[model samples]
Target chain A: MKDEAMALRDTHVTLAHGGGGQAMRDLIDEVFAAVFQPPGMEDQARLAPGALAEAGARLALTTDAFVVTPLEFPGGDIGKLAVCGTVNDLAVGGARPLWLSAAFIIEEGTEVALLRRLVATMAEEARAAGVRIVTGDTKVVGRGAADGVFITTTGVGVIPAGREVSTGQVRPGDVVIVNGVLGDHGACILAARGDLMLSTDLVSDCAALGHLMEAVLAAAPGVRAARDATRGGIAAVLNEIAGVAGVGIEIDEAAVPLRDEVRGVCEILGLDPLYLANEGRLVLFVPEDEAGAALAAMRTLPEGAGAVVIGRAVAAHPGQVRMRTLFGGSRIVDMLVGEQLPRIC
Target chain B: MKDEAMALRDTHVTLAHGGGGQAMRDLIDEVFAAVFQPPGMEDQARLAPGALAEAGARLALTTDAFVVTPLEFPGGDIGKLAVCGTVNDLAVGGARPLWLSAAFIIEEGTEVALLRRLVATMAEEARAAGVRIVTGDTKVVGRGAADGVFITTTGVGVIPAGREVSTGQVRPGDVVIVNGVLGDHGACILAARGDLMLSTDLVSDCAALGHLMEAVLAAAPGVRAARDATRGGIAAVLNEIAGVAGVGIEIDEAAVPLRDEVRGVCEILGLDPLYLANEGRLVLFVPEDEAGAALAAMRTLPEGAGAVVIGRAVAAHPGQVRMRTLFGGSRIVDMLVGEQLPRIC
Candidate 1:
């Protein structure tokens, strides 16, 4: 039964798939139900109580909606992004990702073949993240009412006992480290859109980072906080951390990691890579004494091979972030005043 | 802080609100963060691990997406539907609804005031259902890229100790009971659209059924199975139960509870009340011996004032649903074949 459902695909979807009828049931049975294969046939998925007792002392919940245009992109599609986006959010909050629920809002004329491909990717990613896609819902809108498809994934995880991670824990003399090169996702999506009329071999850095995060936590138990540099890039993350912790952040512009192609695209577009979004990158804060070990641990993973110490926390200029320029000058890095990019995620 | 942020409203939403920038943060603080007020500033909401210990031995998780048009209708809006839709799914599965995560996809140019009104309504409905909106995500797309707004809500709940429910447990001679009048929600949305050129003061029967479901479970703990009549209506639910349990169901048309206005609308439009979607209705399969007490308990609640025995489970014609008409004729009530309604919830 398991392998039999793997090669199946449907060409196009109709409004009936979301009508809560036999057509919908057939669609689910053939596509999602076969893949998920939950324990029972209840409308809701059941998780045994105390299931997380060994993993953590608390539950972490988060959700994200994926509406990235060009559903399929250079390196990954919306499916991989949806899974990794929610999983990364939980991981950055010091949670061991466990279960997820997916809901889809699909246009009536969307090809079922596309949905199958996306679901397959989701299943593969869920397996990589060691989580289950347990429950889901589907709704279909008219042809003109929606884009091709929109996916919203919600995740549940367990926070380890006695391990509290928050921006409030950030203090002076804390080093800031990022997992990998910045802006790969944002840059890749822009180039894929073909609006810039520029071509680059850039691929999105969309991936599940739970395993890498776990490795970092194991080596740097004293890590203060971590955040996925997603929508607003590392600049937004630093500003938010500074604002919430009532501290200031200083980053060396030359020390920040960036791909030459990404740098080129940003330069041509007159956009700052500092504010470009990322899908598989994160910013970590650790006390000065523990920073070395954290960076070493992160560097061991392929996902974090480009890890580097880009900044540090300070008590001066409370609630502010500043960047040291490559020209040996400094300037304030303010929270984005308006939208520099939209639908980049 | 609780009440200080309510007065601000932007004339319209822009790309910045979803850009993960100051504009997005301010909007979240004013609209959602104020209402939810989750503890600590973290990427995910943290919940005590033992919180569900007293409630039951398992957790029930479900998700639903709401794309109902017109945003607002006579009795309820899309916000109310989003909360109630997911909550009722858990409730019908015999779980006490607990926490919810809401994700919103908004089209640029939507009125911020409209979004605020919807968010306020959602908070109110969540409070009424004894659930908290703990985590969320928001995304904005270019104008004409999406409908006005779409919401997908995922819920987590706890099943009570020693309570077990499944369609597999249904048996012959078991009576079926519904909590309230049918099709009000479906009828209301259609009229609200103004496309039918018909309006008769009918409002949607959109309400959280958790409280009412609790009463039913307490009265009939031995109930075989239960299902909420939402997307495909009671007809779809009945057909599913019949097919799953490998049993036949027979319903008396005269016994089904319905409102005159809804019936009039259906009659005028050549629609069957049984096939119209509902928001707060449920069908319970109770043993013949306990059916009377169950119906009585349901009728005591305001949400279930129209409670009545509509049918009985039978062994004949296994895996089929047969309906006895008011004209003394019987016909197979098969699953919905095509899209009768789209974006109804």
Candidate 2:
């Protein structure tokens, strides 16, 4: 029995743990199943489908991996970042997320306390998002294998019938609008690292987007496109739609919203604000005819109060995105090229 | 246009592609959208719901990142290895994988020919696996910023109803079985490096398992658990099943099969055969009553002529796995403590 216990301790990160073995079983029941479960997802112990169909009317699935540096950072840590990132992915994708699966690669000796806190935060975030954590995985690595923790989250959700929206439908003359601020996430992280100081109190704009999307999506079909400007800001998303729809995108830089603090930081950093990332913001492409209605709908929601039209899609320069300068010259807006401030997600 | 094209090539691994801008759009259309494109999928060119859904499902939804060292080794290069490795993951997971998303992080000046061969092999392997090379990403890094190239392949698949299975249900008293020899994958990888020339005949057991799994699934519902023994080998799998079912597992070491060459190599390497990885084989758990039938069904299949019962689940010592020696002493088996080899599959 003592030797058995030793084996248990020693046999750290094997395929069997992921295999649904005692390790896999305990990992799931003790760690994962506890945190990521959406509500009504009991009986996770059994192999049979659990409470999925009962309250499963709404569901969405989103998966992403986290490889941020300095595992622990201000405002949030990797664990919180991992869960919220996927939650937001689903939120902007327009689904009521119910369950999530977190797969982790842990460097050997990741402090148990840190893991515990991370797990606790995962649970907290899931609870905050009103979702359940039903399943997950843990993999141990050799020394020098990797640093700290790498988390991959796959979330599942259900979209209620009759709420169809997509980026492909974005048409020429569609007014591009954004909800609230931009670059706050990237700026806050930068400040948190002591790279800059915020004039106003600044915090990472890391938060779930379910309610915000729900608000805009509820107002119906005129909403042509929605995106969370994470790595490349609004310019990137608008360009994507234009390229996809074979149209040109023209953005009014003056009207493109940014928190003053964020603008100040970006200016000081010599970073283009359009290239900065945003976590707690939404970009919408709406038909010019429905632009007013969309803006009115956006302002009515707490999550969308600062909404404004920032661009339009044109028939010319199909698959191109451009920004009208404050000085009246237009410049091509492109996607981010590489790691712009790593871990800015 | 020239500037745009040059800009696209200038930045090796920009963050923009993920951002949805001109570069991101161009990458998607030129690199991804063009290559992938099987008959039914149209170039929607936008983030349409159907496009996302189709992209997610039409392929196998298998994502794996390659960080293997000695980038080019025996049997295959990292490029070939990454593509095949991911393809195998999809094949075994029961996906008629259609398209793939390849994201690469290449240390600066990786031989272009090596990458071309890798891409070619990816195409070849995709063709060989009856899949497609739809989307891809490339990022160049400063010298020493990375290994030659790290490839993450995200596969997609459409889950045919009534086909999804998990490792959470192997019952007590279920018989454990495996296909052919174990440790071939690890052995082959090691041998291919020429660190030890114990055997020049070592070939990787890397192959798709979908057809084999389909054949086995078609044969019996008594089959409770099925897993491809990859990283942590056969012992890891047995341990996982025992834990999941709240039962004990007893596998006869004598009955657990291994190749003579593999056994010889492990002895020289000071590694246990049971801990070594095998890419092509699957460990199956079936009820005792159906063991005979399952074996017969498996034997008739393409990947299974060498199938045999290696062990059985016991009610004793719940959540534990024990291996019986030829002389009758028992030893407990457990999950792998840490990664046996980093960057291996």
Which predicted model would earn the best DockQ? 1
- Per-residue CA lDDT of model 1 for B1-345, tens digit only, reads 112453345689989889988788877878788887766678799997554655456788999989998899988899999999999999988888989999999999999889889999999999999999998989999887889999999999888777887888899899999988899999998898999999678888899999988888888888889898988899999988987898999999999988899999999999888889999888899999888888888888899888889999999998889999999999988887666788899
For each candidate, what is the lDDT?
0.88, 0.62
lDDT of 1 by residue, A123-172 (tens): 99999999889998888888878888899999999887878778888998
The residue-level lDDT of candidate 2 at A343 comes to: 49
Worst 10 residues of 2 chain B by lDDT: B40-49
What candidate 1 gets wrong by more than 4 Å, as runs, is A1-10, A54-56, B1-9, B54-56
What's the CA error at residue B76 for candidate 1, in Å? 0.5
Q: For model 1, which pairs clash?
A: none
Candidate 2: where is the Cα deviation over 4 Å? A1-33, A37-63, A70-74, A91-99, A107-110, A130-134, A140-148, A157-163, A193-201, A315-343, B1-34, B38-173, B192-200, B315-320, B327-339
- What is each candidate's DockQ, to 2 decimals? 0.65, 0.19
How far off is residue B201 in model 1, in Å? 1.6
Task: Judging by lDDT against the true structure, name the best candidate.
Answer: 1
User: Candidate 1 chain A: worst 10 consecutive residues by lDDT?
Assistant: A1-10
